[model samples]
Target: MLYIIDILGTIAFAISGALVAFDKRMDVFGIFIIAFVTAVGGGTLRDLLIGHTPVGWMNDLTYTYVIIVSTIFAIGFRSKLNYLRTSLLLFDAIGIGLYTLIGLEKGVELHLHPILCIALGTMTACFGGVIRDILCNEIPVVFRRETIYATCCILGGVMYFALGVLPLDHNIVFLASGTIIIATRLLAVRFKIALPNIYRD
Candidate 1:
């Protein structure tokens, strides 16, 4: 189940990256590069921080293949995807939700503190997009006050631990947390929800 979620998350991030690359009118190689980094950037960072050597995609080629395939799909169907208007944002939300769960699970496996686990989850969920945005010369959405991005991941991570105390199955708890993250993001976007700006208007 975790493996499936990881693959799906990779696909989502890759597609999201491809869309961004397309918007920037990048070349094929640039599209693939952006897609690859956005797919595994967060996971790579998490692995390095946790001392998981060689990172994850380096150990397994499945993630690489998934990113390649996803990038191609997004590019090939760029017109159709662009018609949706919100496809990139949708995929990004899905990626973050799935990656958050994967990170939280890894932290638990290593017996890390709950707080650290949540931090790992947030990093796993947001850093990929951060890298993508930085490379694309845009401020990352996670750092913007106009959108509730990392907050969704943090709340989801907290919910994961909160649900852990229940007698529910682990998978159920996992799905619930993921759903919370995804739904929160969609709702936030729909409602124009945002954090208060610190600077004067």
Candidate 2:
């Protein structure tokens, strides 16, 4: 189940990265590079921080294959992809939720402190996009005054840990966490909500 979620998240993030590349009029190779980094950057960072050798995609060729396939599909459907804005947001939200949970689980497995686990989860969910934006020379949306992005991931991670103490099924916990993250993001966008800017004061 976790594997499936991770694959889905990778696909979504890859698509998003490809879209940005396309928007920038990048070449095919550039698009693929952006897609790969956006899909795996966060997880790789988390693994490195936790001392997980070989990282994730380094150990799993399937993840590499998935990102490649996703990039090809995105490129092939470029003309028709303009209508995918809403779909992209949905996929991104799902990715963020799944990544957050997976990061938390990995941190716990490493015997890290709970707070560190939550931090890792948020990083796992958000840092990929941060890298993507940086590479594309744009300020990361996650750091801007947009709707809650990383905050939603952090909240969902906390919820996941709290529910994990119960006798609930693991799938149930995943669903709950994913749902909360997605709903929070959607509602924030719908209402034009945003966190206060630190520089404002």
Candidate 3:
């Protein structure tokens, strides 16, 4: 199940990255570059912080293949697709949702503290988009208070721990947490919900 989620998350992130690249009018190479980084950037950071050597993608070429295929799919279908902002939001939300669960599980396996686990989850979910935006010369959405991006990951991570105390099955717990994360993001976007800005003139 985790493997499936990881693959799906990679695909979603790769597509989202490719979309951003196209929106920026980048070339083919640039599209692939952005897709690659967005798909693996967060996971790489999580692995390094956890002292894991030779990140997951480095150990397997399947991830690379998936990213390439996803990039192509994104670019190939751009014209046929609606190119709606909501589509991008949905894909990004799904990627972050799965990534949050994956990161939280890894932290638990590594015997990390709950707080650290939450942090790892947030990093795993948001770092990829952060790098993508930076490379595209835009502000990282997660860094924006109004984005409600990383906050979704953090809330989902917290929900994971909360659900852990229940007598539900582990699979159910993970699914519920991830679903909540995705739903939160979609709702936030639909309702234009966000944290209040702290900056004042």
Candidate 4:
């Protein structure tokens, strides 16, 4: 189940990255490169932070394959995606939610502190987009106060640990936490919710 979720997350981020590349009028190689990094950059950073050797994609070809397929699919359906208007945001939200859990699980496996686990979750969920934006020559959304991006991941992580003491199954806990993250992001976008702008005119 975790493996499935990870794959889905990878696909989501890959598609999002491909869409961004399309918006930038990038070539096929650039599209593939952007999708690949956006799918695995966050997880790679998380693994390295925890001293997990060889990283994740190096150990599993599945992620690379999935990203390749996802990028191709996105490019094939670029017209349909452009019509959706919110496709990029939707996929990004879903990607962060799923990756948040993947990172939290990794931290837990290493018996890390809960706070550190939450930090890992946020990093795993946001760093990919950060890398993507940097490569694309745009400021990362999570760094912008225009929306509460990474905060959603942090809240989801908090909720995950909060539910840890409950009698619910671990899968249920994951679903609930991930849902919180996804829903929070969607709602924030829907309502134009954001942290106050620090730079006053």
Top-TM-score candidate index: 2
Candidate 2: which pairs clash? none
**Which has the higher lDDT value, candidate number 2 or candidate number 3?**
2
Please count the clashing residue pairs in each candidate, in the order shown.
Answer: 0, 0, 0, 0
Output the worst ten-in-a-row residue range by lDDT, candidate 3: 80-89
The digit string of per-residue lDDT tens for model 1 on 63-128 reads 888988888888888889867557666766787898898888899999999999999999988898
Q: Candidate 3: where are CA atoms >4 Å away?
A: 83-88
> Stretches of candidate 4 above 4 Å error?
85-88
* Candidate 1 ranges with C-alpha deviation above 4 Å: 1-5, 84-89
lDDT of 4 at 57: 88
lDDT of 2 by residue, 122-174 (tens): 99989988999998999997888878999998889888888989999988987
Cα-based lDDT at residue 193, candidate 3: 85
Give candidate 1's root-mean-square deviation (CA, Å). 2.0
In Å, residue 96's CA in model 2 sits off its true spot by 0.9
Give each model's whole-structure lDDT.
Answer: 0.87, 0.88, 0.87, 0.88
Per-residue CA lDDT of candidate 3, range 1-201, in tens?
Answer: 667767877888898888889999999999999999999999899999888889978999999999999888888888865655566667678879988888888999989999999999899899998999999999996787775888889999999999999999998988999998999989898888889867793
Locate the minimum summed-lDDT window of 10 residues in model 4: 82-91
